[model samples]
Target chain A: MPSLFFTRLRQGQRTLPFPDAGPDLPERFRGLPIIDQSLCPSGCDACVEACPTDAIASDDSLAIDLGRCLFCSECSNACPQGAIQFSRQYQLAASRRADLVLKTGQSLQLAHRLADDLHRILGRSLKLRQVSAGGCNGCEADINVLNTVVFDLGRFGIQFVASPRHADGLLVTGPVTRNMSLALEKTYAAVPHPKIVIAVGACAIAGGPFREHPEVLNGAGAILAVDLFIPGCPPHPITILDGLLRLIGKIASPAAAHGEAP
Target chain B: MTISLPSFHNGEPISLASVPLLSIREFREEIIAAAGAGATLTALFGTPAESGRVRLFSVLGDPVAGGLAALSAEVDDAYPCLTVECPQAHWFEREIAEQWRIEPQGHPWLKPIRFQAPYRPPGRTWARLPGVTDFFAVRGPEVHEVAVGPVHAGIIEPGHFRFQCHGERVFHLEISLGYQHRGIEPALVGGPGKRTIHMIETLSGDTSIGHATAYCEAMEGLGGVAVPARAQALRAVALELERLANHTGDLAALAGDVGYLPTAAYCGRIRGDFLNLTAAICGSRFGRGMVRPGGVLFDVDPRLAADLTRRLDNALKDLEDAGRLMWDAPSVQARFQDTGAITAETCAALGLVGPAARACGVERDIRQDFPSGFFRFAQIPISRWSTGDVFARAWVRWLEIQRSGVFVREQLASLPHGAIQTPVGAPRPDHLVVVLTEGWRGAIAHVAITDPNGRFARYKVIDPSFRNWIGLAIAMREQQISDFPLCNKSFNLSYCGHDL
Candidate 1:
């Protein structure tokens, strides 16, 4: 055992490149939301009611505030929207909230019929800033791992930055407890325009199951227009990798919605 | 002739019947005898008595029903020490000495356990004086102390570990906790459907399920409410997921700490996957909201059921391969081996629980001994070893992970179908309920009373970290400075959990 100690001392810094090496993530991992208009229920707007961020709105048909939807999968479960299928493709880089929206009532008919769309990047790096609104620390744990050698997001032109001023993406976690509300809003406001807001935990999504409380803040959508919602109380690192890859346009489909998130 | 004191005036002992009162010296000897005979000392409950000092309520044995015992000791102003016999009484004695100034006589080690800032307000009667270890404070080769945290880099909880080290090797370690105390014990008096459960939920963010489970059991025990078998099975499944989530994350962290990148990342990913499954099943990645007082708050739908049963199968398999690589990986093994080795003797003396105890070869699991609800109907295996080192601990966690994954699968396959929760019946008053749970970290024992209004009269939670902190200090006995993180994580006792 003593001899074994000398040999084992130098095993640090072996990195597994994610995003750049771009490991093939699964289709079932909860990613963003896509609307299935046919399955959209009528007049039952529990999804809208359940949405903590007011990410979903209904007028005979539910319209997912793609920018607001936390992909917490709450709407997917409550939607007259069996309409919300968790999209498997992870690369969802968008400059506007409209890009994240899902229309449940045949609104995407022509858009769906169109050929595959590919957008060009301007060669700018994607910088991410994480703000924990009110998570139980699971998502933060996953985010920390993303910087590790295994899922080093830096390999994919995506970087985790220290400040909102340098970030193009926002990784907001937690269920938005009452105390974290001001900080959450201030953080979103600090990030410049053309930046995408990605709510990572179920707390930031549809407030997850902790929504049973009046004290819990719901998701970050109540404060800003969210671009991508990664459902799961704390999403898988690969699921996170999948989400990051999708934001960079490397993946063509978003992963499935969190089982219950809309 | 009976001597009646002012403090005891008319106060009744902790037990009226089924327990006989023993004089101070005789009681202390009986306790030592019982503890020496392998009767686990469950707790030492202290209450102000007629003796003008606090009386010790020593709960003894691993008997199916708890053993009740009490002893009355006169408060002594001189020679405040009692650790010579009952080693377990060291902390409790010091606590009593500091709080009420009653010294435990003839104790070998006497140190301050609480009231760190010292009794202030220019001192009052029965208050400990401004005291410091002047003997160790002197200059001759006095080990330079390195005070690390109540705040540290990284995301773990807060604890102040004072290291007495000579150069790179550690000589002594003193850990000061409770800085992050949120007064969870006092807050448990909130009425039913009150904010108390939620307060309990936040006691230890990671051990939410364990705390809530223990709370529910205490409620169940007091109310005599029989939860449906479906709820029992669901609780078991949730527990498995909770255990898997924490163990996997901790494993990944240990591998990462040892600088095994692939193993760390892979295990990290698997951890996320398992948490994803937890989120899928119960919505909260940590399974927090899933547990309520009467039963679970929600159910696992078919879609999640499929993902948990199928998709997770692959993740678990991949995780096993990753864990295998991590385990067999020579560097990871050496990184942990003997890094933070606690002696088996210390483990037995302290009566620690969970992986820390298991790593040190003292086998105890509340799930196995004091099974409640689902565990009463389940087979929760206890894995242990005698290496008393970090490597042994990490190995124990990994093995437990395998069993945990299997447990989830087994519970899911045999899941009884029904509503996740039933309407909680009104709590009854005047009942004392005690419930114990083996959390992701260790055993969490909850003791509470139903007030006349069916609300909590007094609720007390004893997290395993309280006992395991002793092991942590013992592990640092002769280790080097750099191995602090290894030792800390090996025990990984929660500061928030214990402080609460």
Candidate 2:
């Protein structure tokens, strides 16, 4: 018991004061991608052609759908002109699906505080029920990580409850597979009214890598009315936390959200 | 004359012509004979052949020799079931039936593993939607059934569990999954396209490094690309880091399940620390983009290497302190020791791999048995425990955690110097490659057969969860129903990995 106490003491205060001061993201960590179309030669479509998920518009002046991007850096690697680069911008949550598609000079419209009534109800203490439809468990893993000591998601009063009945909204992951479509719908139905839905990760936002696969329904937005979208192969835990906090008005500066990297 | 199956080393490509195509009877005998001689059934899948016939390929892995024997037989409608004699072929056969719309005539339990439309529907649809089917039931007046869900009570993937129980004791446990299936296998039958690596990386998200490495190995083999030594070392380092993170998380979850908060809380944070180390090397915590076809995408410079080594040492120390608390606590031991015990014989019969089998005293590890990539040059000793219980599983993981920690440190300290990646070309035509990676959970096997046009004719992925899910079910037999969660965590099988 004494050793346990000592271990706890040694581990000491791990929870980051995130939002107050952003956590230090690794230099190599690929977050919000920056595309400078001006550098692209008129005939050269290297990034567009090299894009795996068709994330980059083929008939384009360089616009990338972050929802469809796996952030594998193949596009960047294939771009001979160094027109595209992934900046270490971890805050990439958007209020609408349209905001996830970033053009050369456009910034993402970060998720806004929930509708006045919903914010008033869930602003302080929002309980979410997570449904992993056809997810690979990547998003789920990071979501679970938020509850760990470092993130301490509970500190923000955002707890993941067991039952949908007890939840105020749904936090969804994965490209909604036909097999899981019914279960996701049922879980959403079980949640009380005034419920908001958040699509987390690339799959949940726009099917990620499995887009247009016959087995998937593209994403949660295909079936449910999604209020928020966090885009990543599996969005980093900090990205997820930032999304939740902003949606609930716990952290409310949309100006400081996208395109900024430390 | 004795019929010999074409054998190849791990990650080595074999021409489709070189593989012997035996008669159905011969193929069946070869499979059963190999199983009898202690060969693990690595993969058994079907591909659409000429004349509307379905060609079935069976891969038998000989762990002792570190070689794989492969043979094929064409089945038009239905053939003799291999599961009757070889229990390990049970899931693979059902998968074939569901995917190719061919039946395993006499499989004791035949059902769609993933409830999706067949890839090649032989004039009809045999597949049903998820959870709309029958489960093996135990009939008795005192027997009451408990069904737990596709949508569970945790922040986990979806799968259903039906426990045929009397009071708290269970008669039998049946697990039906498919909720996470996204037709990844069927969707992969093409050249190494843009979306291929991304799909493989997410095949089993937690085992991203494992599955991705397997796919990359297969591609490297088919494309005849020589990976640089430095990239190999970094990949192995990343792999061990993945193993460290997952095994630590499992131990923490096991502790959390037993209501031991101190260790759980500490290890949980330490798990993130390990994940952060992986993220340090590659952008993603799950090691998604770190591993490419020819080699790794990210390089650990000298300064970064030293920094990672220091961070790893600190995290390992924290894990050791946290783990000690759980092992020393009597309450935690009482809950973990004998609960959900499965015998070594059961483990072998069910073809369990990784720590689950190691916990049962089965000395099988892909790194040690069928070494590939960095594993060929560097080796981690196989960790084992004979108890075959929750405690043994946890202990095996802890032992592995320490060994993997040491391995990662060594690799990081003395990384080989070279280019990070080599240009990989299209896969060679009419070749087949099987790659086995020892994921944190278990062996992740990927088999790719290419077409004449240098595209994928068929792609098969067998996650460790597919082999060990039944092991979890069998472990729950006769145990207290309350211990299901603990037992479930002990195995920690992937639903999507299986469903896919």
On DockQ, the candidate that comes out on top is 2
Q: What is the per-residue lDDT of model 2 for residues B150-202, given as tens digits with 9 covering 90 to 100? A: 99999999998899999999999988899998888878987578789888989
- lDDT by residue (A87-199, candidate 1, tens digit) is 65444333333544555532211011111232243123677777765455556676777775656667677777766777665777765644445555666677786666777
Share of real interface contacts recovered by each model? 0.05, 0.89
Per-model RMSD to reference: 9.8, 1.7
- Compute the DockQ of candidate 1: 0.08
> Lowest summed lDDT over 10 consecutive residues: which window, candidate 1 chain A?
A107-116
Candidate 1, B117-154: lDDT as tens digits: 21212343332221223223212374687876443445
What would the DockQ be for model 2?
0.85
